[model samples]
Target: MNTLNLADGYKVDHRNQYPEGTELVYSNWTPRKSRIPGVDKVTFFGLQYFIKKYLQEDFDRNFFNKPKQEVVAEYRRRINAYLGPDAITFEHVEALHDLGYLPVEIKALPEGTRVPLRTAMFTIKNTLPQFFWVTNFLETILSCVIWMPCTSATISLEYRKILNQYAIETGGDMEFVPFQGHDFSFRGMAGLEAAMMSGAGHLLNFTGTDTIPAIDFLEEYYNADATKEMIGASVPATEHSVMCMGTELDEIETFKRLINETYPTGIVSIVSDTWDFWKVITEYVPQLKEQILVRDGKVVIRPDSGDPIKIICGDPEAEVGTPEYKGAVECLYETFGGTISETGYKLLDQHIGLIYGDSITLERCQQICENLKQKGFASTNVVFGIGSFTYQYVTRDTFGFAMKATYGEVNGQGREIFKDPKTDDGTKKSARGLLGIYKDANGNLEMKDRADYETEAGGELKTVYKDGQLLVEMSLAEIRDLQAQEVAMDLTQEESI
Candidate 1:
């Protein structure tokens, strides 16, 4: 791992080897439109993390020089393994080794700002015209870094808006909204990096997370110190395996021990659907009510399987009087009767709550909030564990993210280039010419094409990366502030509508 070879890192054919007179290829990536309508703005994030993690290290010449021959041999060996011994024709990657650094410049919107669809978050191009191929060569890494974090940020913002609306209508404390949508996706993401990156995005709006690497990621790249700042955190929680160790016959004892002996002074979550979810709610909870009520902490009940909406907020159509009829909230209400607030919202007893972590979608979140309101319950009575279903089940095309070279220079001439494939409809048509992002009359981020960077005084994009150095760094607090501004704007607009 000490010697780095990128021969198979990208599509071998995409090495930018040939395209007549195409000494440079310029491209721009935009989320043409959201797959989910009304998702018009996306949160710009993860650029700092990606640049610090992937681009600023092990990639350039100085680092590669230490193991120069080994790096060259690996590249040659891998390429030859794929294309045959003599098909290797690119000077054994020595050109890159001798060059000693990447020749690239990157500009981007500050992390945490809201960008309108089709606006570029960041643009990359080769600083040395001869290394123009490096622009697209970096795409393999850029796409992986950009799309997922942005997508996760966008999704978390949408959740924030939903929770904010519910907080307003249900008289729940808005200050507590950030911790409502917790991250439980560490075990479910594509990899550790994926979890860390997406989890960082989640922390932009909330401080609750189970992804531990995210805290480390924020500390490393975003100037966040857990000892000094309230970074992502979570409480002790149990899974089926931990509960099943004592057997289902002793399940009630497990709950008693969790409340009385373990984690008695802070929030602790216990998954309650191991053998029988309804029995735990109707039978087991009553047995532990004294311990739960006097523990001076919260006990959050987790329902791992079942339709989340019906499980959290009861099915109005189900048989009304049977033990099988009541849901978690209703059952909890029966055991410890709660008082309604002035806004007519049911405030669950301080010691008990509900959480549903499985198969939660945006629509499910909306429905759950609305259903709880209809039942005179505050939306804050429950917390949501947004799992990989929200973070992992996405792709670049989820928002039509595509990076294409729009302008390049060659032979002392600058050319504006774009792709308008007529073979299909217009989803693939890209922007033409050099681009600039500026705020318009309404202070919304907008894109301008065929623009000069030096004279564009109104442009908001700034140089963040040049050559091998990261020129601009962002802290998590700065990102959170940007997101808060955008959320305030969105809420204002929503009220007018």
Candidate 2:
């Protein structure tokens, strides 16, 4: 027979937990793609597919319901044809199953920030350019690795800033500059890959996440945990006390009882004003202040309903020159009637903090900020937990993202070509030829034309795979850390308004 039956009785629980320090290494890599048969070459290709397959694990085929072996074989052939023949084999196949699709060398910005179009977040320099055809297959996976996380992260950063400004405009004094919290996006994520990406988004600016796998991935893949060393890091965590999604007198009592049981030491939060906000604030807040805020220490109060402008809304009747809400009032004490103190001081009123999760966004944040300006509450001590619209459903992220074949150089002549699509669906058009990179005075990236692929300045575009060998080696922690740094440094901010 085919001797393939020997692979039987192998209960490959591809889903089982791997041992802690187990590393899947492609040890014999050579940085050159072999000129092999049945291979294709193209610039900036397969980027979207790579992200979905490796990071997302999206393998749903209606084309056929064939055996798992057949599907896996095709994948192996494709990977080997492009990466290297020696890159993988039967002996190490099980390990490959363990690592998922590993994130290779990626150039990306941190999760929360702005990025410009037509620039490299990071580049994939194939270790094996000669194996041109095989190495080109990675274009999909490499591009997908970047696109969405960077996009969602950039947007979320602005959302929080706007909310903080709004709270200040409405007369709420900001206390903590960057508040500590967790990402509750588990219910909002599209899938495990999305969940993981969201977790990366959480780490960009916020403290931490509640997802255990996310935690494990962060540690195993990134090697950095906020709970321990980093003084400012937020190692996300939570407790399962019940909650009331409404505002009422009984609701306040219910919230109080839960607080009493869960955080007897005094640090916690309750979703106040489930029905009637001002009334609950007037009736319950003062009474529970001692036990909830003083007994152990201090707890944060969350107001999920009502316009943040009104709840922290200042009295317009107060003169601009008066304290607290006065436009000309310069000092915190002049405005709040008391100097800054820990329990009740200028800072408490001037430096107090909170989280606004109700329909918050960048534009909404800007509006809130304007409202606060009129109210005299200009403090940068709050955060916004963005949800649903942006973070939850991000599938178009095909990165639809593509790199063009800007210029192709034949034996001695070079030609510049652009795909003239019969019907342009966005991704249909692309630049023709070999790609090269250059750095400008500001250290930013610039792509230039190449008249000859046989001798281009940026070396060959292909890397990592060479002559049936893998040229470079990477660790998950290393890739994760690099991605983290790349995202953080992704600021293309303009100084003027």
Candidate 3:
């Protein structure tokens, strides 16, 4: 009885054409043979396809952009150039055709699955036994597509958690937590594959980005939309500028220049600090303030150094510092008296706005509201101008990830697979199996694999090339969305294994 199994059922057809089993294609990897098949002896066609579609796409963009015929020719030339002209003789091609396993596709793990330690998120197997060794060269692409998205997505999710807490304390009322994280770690990623993964990180959970290149990758390889709303550009906001009358000619001129440049259009605001803030407000503000109004007659002056939460807690915008602030306070008391003027009252109400910028932590955010109650600062008057401590550096390198080879079938036996005992740190685990992504009850994920050279499950990644006529073309976003959704589901409990 013939025991050879191929993607297009070899029975009754190619049995007369080719030899079976070991005489077929295999990777040229030969270690002291363990329980399952070890990598050994690859064929030409598989190597050619891998170089055309994946290796070149990542290593050289020119490799990716060139026409398919050019790519195949280049690949063949390189193979012959390196391995010798006699290496890929016609007999090799004929032998591969006889095997009846020419193409296959890996369904793969989705992009943001919160993958735990040690799992093969991808599976690769034969499309035609004759081409099995020819196709094995695609292992590199599997790694590129799978882990890059996995690691980046995990980091982005963590960033959101920290920002979420900070936003709540700072008086942000939102229906849901929004992502404003970047794949900042992209700078440290391994290579082109990692760069693409960095972009995927944003898709799983993030809002804006400074990495513009990643945006393009998402559109090309994964399929995601580039929208202003996704990047925090849709929020309409207003701003203003003001100065203390007595700092210097330049400071006053600078403020006046800015004021003249911006009033009667958008929101108008001024900072009355520099020197004797109270005196400037009691003197210069009452008249020019009206001239500076917008359609809603609202203006915003920024608060810094002093406790910002108090500004929104319902208090006046006074000079807040050391002995210097006291001088301004006293000058105002002498110049305008202690009966807080209608100007201060109006500034604290709807017509005016107070904006603050400083070491605004979640703790400080709470204080801003608390002090507002103590100082009588209007909550609506205060608009936070948060910087440094809150916007950047949310998540560190915490998520641990690793890829493990799980299943395969070879010879007459079928079983799960794993790497050789550790001699190399983390870099030595190579795949050897038929793999698949699984979701158990409670939405957890698991990778199922048959050992190298073992019987595989029915579903395999399909290569869509029939008669060498490229039959399928998938856009990046379509794949990205698919990846994004896959990651949204649960994987195995990290602690469970």
Model 2 misplaced regions, further than 4 Å: 1-115, 122-145, 157-182, 208-212, 225-241, 244-250, 258-261, 306-353, 393-400, 403-417, 420-429, 451-497
Number of residue pairs clashing in candidate 2, backbone atoms closer than 3 angstroms, sequence gap of 3 or more or interchain: 66
Winning candidate number (lDDT): 1
Q: Rank the candidates by lDDT, best first.
A: 1, 2, 3
Q: Estimate each model's TM-score.
A: 0.93, 0.58, 0.47
Please give the lDDT score for candidate 1. 0.81
The lowest-lDDT stretch of 10 consecutive residues in candidate 1 is 1-10
Candidate 1, number of clashes = 6
Q: Can you give the lDDT of residue 278 in candidate 1?
A: 90
Per-residue accuracy of model 1 over 1-497 as CA lDDT, tens digit each: 42233323445545445454556666665787788757888888888887877776647433455566777666668767877886645652566667877778888888898888878887888787666677877776677678888899999999998998898888787877888999988898999889988998889998888888999989999999999889887888999999999799999999988888888798899999998999899899988888888888889999999889988888778899754456678789889777776688987888998888898888899999998898888898889999899989888888888778888776657788877889957888878778888887999878888887563334777888888789999888889999988888888998999
Least accurate 10 contiguous residues by lDDT in model 2: 25-34
Best by TM-score: 1
Question: Candidate 2: lDDT over CA atoms?
Answer: 0.40
Query: lDDT of each structure?
Result: 0.81, 0.40, 0.39
Give a tens-digit lDDT track for model 2, residues 403-455.
Answer: 33343223324446456677865444543344344456865444443335443
The runs of at least 3 residues in candidate 1 whose Cα sits more than 4 Å from the true structure, single-residue gaps closed, are 1-24, 60-63, 323-326, 453-458
Q: Which portions of model 3 show Cα errors greater than 4 Å? A: 1-73, 76-102, 134-136, 141-146, 165-171, 175-197, 220-417, 422-437, 447-497
- Lowest lDDT 10-mer window, candidate 3? 36-45
